[model samples]
Target chain A: MLANYGYSDGSGDYFITIDTQRCNACGACVMACPSQVLVTVDEDPNDPENDGPVVVAHGDRVRKLRYECDPCKSTANTTMPICVVVCKTFAISHSW
Target chain B: MSVDKQPEFWRWDETNWVNRDIEWINSEYITLGIDIGSVSSQAVIMCDGEIYAYGNMRTGSNSPNSARNALEFALEGATMKESDIHYCIGTGYGRVNVPMADRSVTEIACHARGANFIYGPSVRTVLDVGGQDIKAIRCDEKGKVTNFLMNDKCAAGTGRGMEVLSDLLSVSIGEVGDRSFDIEVEPSPVSSACVVYAKSEATALLRQGLNTNEVLAAYCLAMAQRIWSLLERVGVEPEFAITGGMAKNRGVIDRLCKKVGLEPMKTRWDTQLAGAIGAALFGYSLCRKGKSKRR
Candidate 1:
């Protein structure tokens, strides 16, 4: 139940990847996130196609992350956003 | 340089320094947190885990200077030198800009810890409406962040929006909250969501013969509603507490609490100093951890 959101602009390709199957929805990433870009949603509690509850980016933030997430990239300790680091399940990834 | 010539609009006098009733010389492990924010800065000094002294001041053009000045203000009345502090951690929008900080932590982490300290361990939710942004955070009993949401890109639901309205009505920013309640009836929220549009609409309302209090009531209502939407997205729970500058606005706080149907936890501590206090607490914990690790 992996989901991808966002698009490529003139600067680069930006995308936030969520692997629902691996996600436990502990929401540590959401808290670690400085910009509050991610949110948790209950797709369907008992549905087979969807994994109960998973974190996803807002429709509005998908585009804004291209600029919003840039601060995470500036530091040497982090190449990816802090959300990816705090996501213990390794369910979320970013493409830039 | 003439105080009489200055406009009262968009300006409010903030308490520059505060301290707990205690003797600092008796405590060990002194740590500090300098929070250099968009519109203001705070420096909090802690002995062990208890607050010793703090300073809250308006931020100047230079971030490092703001951080230093805040620390100096706090230390002015206290018997401590800059070199006597064990560690300095910076938090807020300008966290990394604090040249004197030994390290830095994000505002999210700092706010959660600060809220826990002020409101007790029961606090699970924190809503901070700062100068240029708003944050809704959910944390655990231990004061570690679990989930959070922020509205930083926009001016609405922030202190800047209230400042704009104050300037428009030619009233002191501090009086806007109290004046909102002076209206005969509760006014419906303004239609425009953007601060710029809302400001113009408020001006037009005045032109239509509505009084300043009425226009202010309308804006306050709108602000409460706007913040309510953001809080809804994150989901609200009991034991909620609010931080940052907007928490002082009685109108917004009362309206927000009524709409959410929950009483936000109260505190005697200054709400704006939450971030810096949290940072100082972090420094305190870190120092203890390091000492234990060495042993």
Candidate 2:
């Protein structure tokens, strides 16, 4: 399941897609996210049947991604988002 | 000195109605459901699984106050008092902010349950186009969500986008639907994926000698198309039902139905209260289950 979080507004689309099949509940993405946009939950809120822990975009920050992720996207030194770079499974991607 | 009241062109009606046939006082359990959505708020009061009364109103800046106002509006002219409510559940974007809610449920689950009650057991697909988001939900006969997808990030397919179009064209929100149909030829939809760009495109069309109604038709068509793509991703099923503010708009609904080749199931109750109705029903069931557990 490709869980896409965030929204498209008048400005543009800002989404964080997580491939749940590859995610192993690793907290690396959570720790790497400087804006605290990701969290590891015991259950996937979108998938009620999944009982295992998985990483998901924070609910509160989903709507405010443009602002919350501004620091990382605006910096020239960073080649990629910290969360995407740190994910060993390569299950995370962004649509900006 | 009293200032002259200004007319709010974009304002929709807010009202409450009670089922006079139900004698709520004698009911063993009375449950309340409050839905504090981004654009509107609703409160539903149920007596023994039957809808006793419901109030629909525009959401205020403060969610707690909005919930309180909606509940008070529903209780107005009724024999029941706040103390009579045995259980309370809240749903919607501001669900957690409801001061009186004993529990909170997701709007996705609440809408499925509420649609089952309002549209009947045959309903399998629910499309809720709310103020800031669009949700396409598939549910079982028992109103349990089987699968669901939600898009809250964009304003292109939402009520907020419609409101902006209405205000831009100086058309009342209620008349946008009917007036859109009045145009002789349906213009191609506005060529923008974002509401901001669409607004500018609408202004350009107006400059190019398009009438207000014609411009409205184009925008409505775009909105319908935008929503249709989302529904396609979720796979629409038979006995489809639409809830929330968009349910009341025929301009988008009619076009979308024509494109999808399926008419939406109708409901007698106000479509905006679907979330609240589901919340109240859930509360009632929880109360019953809790009672049985204690025994």
Candidate 3:
């Protein structure tokens, strides 16, 4: 299941998407996160039956991604965010 | 001092320190660390390896001015000037904007290192409740960060949240800690995690005939709970120590320690200066490395 974190604004729609099905709950994403924007939940938000808890973006950070992630987003060129790059499971993706 | 009468709930009146053990002239290297945070700023000057002078002040509107003023306050009454400092490292939110700093470091790294010095090598966990955020850090003996967690873009579990309650209750910021413990009955924690909603919750409790102290106690408990969850994410291990503005709030610290079942490591220095102290120590190492490399 895909769960999206972030909001739409005047500029455009931005999001940090987490695919729980693809995640293995390895916690690499959580450890690699510099800002602690992602955390491991006890139970999967997207799947109650899955039982395997997974990492998801912080609730407080979900709304302010555009501002909070301004530093990580490369304006000069395209580059994956640290959270996206570090996730070996390829369970995370960002839209801008 | 500004003649403003708004009750300065955000104000934390405290003095800076300068260790007398070091003589600036005799030291081969003099390095400085400036931590410019959202609510406060600090500057620490180290002569050779020991602390020489330091300043702590409320941050101003402009970060550059705040950094300069904090350093100047530390340098006050001393013969040394800014020009005499060999190197400067800036840390915290405004680290990049420090006009005088040679480089900048993250507050997380700086806090861990500072906690190491203040609380000793046993501090495996550090919970820093600064102006707008809470950080839960796990560091090794050398003060290197191994793992950490931080609250994201929220002021709910930080110094700003306490200041909001202080303003709402018409109580001085310094008085919040002592007044909270004065309440006879332990109130339930406030329901809301957001500061705005928490204010309304607090107002409702007050209208429900709770005394001001009772309401304050409730808020402190709620604040402790909010940060406690963040600490859980990092998986707390002792010896634990706390740093930043919230460390001064004994009510919260005592409750938090009780909730977590660990006694915090003690430190005589101001907890708010942890990031600056860490940055200064980093500067000391950097200067020492430079001198050794040159030789």
* Per-model lDDT: 0.79, 0.86, 0.80
TM-scores of all models? 0.77, 0.82, 0.76
Clash numbers, per candidate = 0, 3, 0
DockQ of each: 0.06, 0.23, 0.05
Candidate with more favorable, higher DockQ: 2 or 3 = 2
Better of 1 and 2 by TM-score: 2
Query: Which TM-score value belongs to model 1?
Result: 0.77
Itemize residue pairs with steric clashes in candidate 2: A7-B153, A8-B153, A8-B154
Q: Which residue ranges in model 2 land beyond 4 Å of their true spot?
A: A1-4, A8-56, A64-96, B1-6, B291-295
Q: Candidate 3 at B19: error in angstroms?
A: 2.6
- Order the candidates by TM-score, highest first — what do you get? 2, 1, 3
Question: On residues B89-192, what C-alpha lDDT tens digit does candidate 2 reach at each position?
Answer: 89999999999888787888789889999999999889999988888888889887765667876767789888888877878899999999999988998886
Candidate 3 structure quality by residue, lDDT tens digits, B72-180:
8998887888888888889998898899988777787789888998889999999999987777888889887766555535677688888888888888888888999
What share of the reference contacts survives in each candidate? 0.00, 0.22, 0.00
- In terms of DockQ, which candidate is stronger, 1 or 3? 1
